[model samples]
Target: MATRNIYYKSKTGILHWLGLAIAIVLLDQISKIWISHILHYGQAIRITSFFNLILVYNEGAAFSFLASQSGWQRYFFTAISILAVVVIVYLLKKHAHQRLFCLSLALILGGAIGNLIDRSLYGHVIDFLDVHAMGWHWPTFNIADCGITIGAVLFIIDELKRVRKS
Candidate 1:
């Protein structure tokens, strides 16, 4: 009689990664909701000498690109995010066993979905975190943006490690 190794075979599904993604989305949404409830649009609450909490509505991509354009950008961005989510899901499912790769995809998927929910519900994404120094202010962002940025960094690291290993 042969003994089956359940632990080895059970690592091939995306459920674990998907759960992480869902957690990120929930955290992003809850933070945004809390910010919205406490601050009026355009209100800035200084948290430190270099950091501030502000309410901003972004209608376009990163760094406010296309934000000034007529409302068409909302639907365009939403569609793009949806497509990205689908791709991420496929990648996650395909490489579930690759822990680092799946983790990167999960973070990106969560961020994308978080922004998608905002776009679908409010016609724009809510940004609250603000960083500034020496009279220069960085673009305001939120938890979703942080997740996406971190995920992108991790993805790069994973790729670099893979290339080096080969």
Candidate 2:
């Protein structure tokens, strides 16, 4: 007798992962909205001895790469994020049975879409969460950035586990 995975045989399983993605997007957007409503642009609110909540608008990729460039980078990054969402969706559908892989893709998909919405509407992504230690401050980031970073790390771990299994 052989064991069968029902999740891979039905559409509902895929929807379950998609739902996770949607939830991430909603949470990301809500957090951004709350931050915007409470904080003025470039304003920082101390949360802890080593952390603060601040408002920042990022017009470029991670760590504000190309943020100082002309306006063209906005369109470029938006397009790239849109393309990444498409790819992540496709991967999710194809490998939904692979729990960790699908989870990683779903998180990335949600994060990508969350930032994409901001870029399309405001030409920049809103960032609020900030961390500092020893007089050094890390770049400000938001929920979407957290999702993407965590997802990327999970993806690497999943790949390593897969390689080990093989």
Candidate 3:
């Protein structure tokens, strides 16, 4: 059986994705701002036994990887983020009718935009959430990173559902 377009008559799908993306970006920025003003670098506000808010600045990709490349990583990361945004837009356009797919892409787009904004405006991404176990601490991350992580998981789930139906 063929799936008739569920969202052909309206642009709700596109708007939905755009809305989510904007919301994520806004929330990410606001949180970063709050963290910056409220907490000093390396200061931690313990939230639980395993979680804390640690003010951190990341100059590289996720997990603070390659954050110390003598300042050359900013442009490289910015270029990569731009490319990712282009690809995400393409995917959003192509799968606009697929709500789950569009949503997943939108989440990722928002995250990319969030971090890209940081990279372009500040030359670094601000990370705050810090999880730890015993003496080891997980990498700190922000709302944008959370958005990306959620989006990736949602994409995987959507794909699996589609496969199961097929």
Candidate 4:
């Protein structure tokens, strides 16, 4: 008689994805809280000539691109985030067997949830990391944005690799 391998088949992997997503959200939220309480808005704690820790509020999308749209951006961005979260969850459930794809979805889920918390609670997103050059400044961002960007890049890379493999 052959012994069947039951360990891998018995495992339910939802927790793995959920755990990673929650961890990312927690870290992002905690950092934002620390920045909000310890750093004044528009004030920078200079860590280096190129980088600074500055507390800024963003009501729009990446880099504060639409942050000055007469205050309607808050709701727009919030709606966009909610829709994104829903879509990501569906994709994750559908492709849970794909490790890289599922991980990317998890990262995006955490990031979207992190920013959504801010939009729902404070009506704006708290941004703290600042980069500067030539006496000019780039828009500040937080961990959630970094996670989302990284996840996006990874997703693209995964797709490219899949194509090459086939």
Candidates by lDDT, descending order: 1, 2, 3, 4
The top-ranked prediction according to lDDT is 1
lDDT of candidate 3 at residue 134, scale 0 to 100? 84
The C-alpha TM-scores of every prediction are: 0.92, 0.93, 0.89, 0.88
RMSD of 1: 2.5
Name the lDDT value of residue 148 in candidate 3. Answer: 94
Prediction RMSDs, each to the true structure: 2.5, 2.2, 3.0, 2.9
Candidate 3 lDDT, 1-166, residue by residue in tens: 9899755654556677788999999999999999999999999999999999999889999887789789999999999999998998888877787888888889999999999999999999999999889899788999999999999999999999999999
Locate the minimum summed-lDDT window of 10 residues in model 3.
6-15
Q: For model 2, how does the per-residue alpha-carbon lDDT over 26-82 read when each residue is reduced to its tens digit?
A: 999999999999999999999899999999999998999999998999999998998
Candidate 3 deviant stretches above 4 angstroms: 1-7, 134-136
User: What are the lDDT scores of the predictions, listed in order?
Assistant: 0.93, 0.91, 0.90, 0.86
Best by the TM-score measure: 2
Candidate 4 lDDT tens digits, 2-57:
88765443143656776888888999999999988998889889999899999999
Residue pairs in clash, model 2: none
Instruction: At residue 67, give the lDDT of candidate 2.
Output: 97
Q: Against the correct fold, how does model 2 do in TM-score?
A: 0.93
In the range 4-53, model 1's lDDT, one tens digit per residue, is 87556445479999999999999999999999999999999999999999
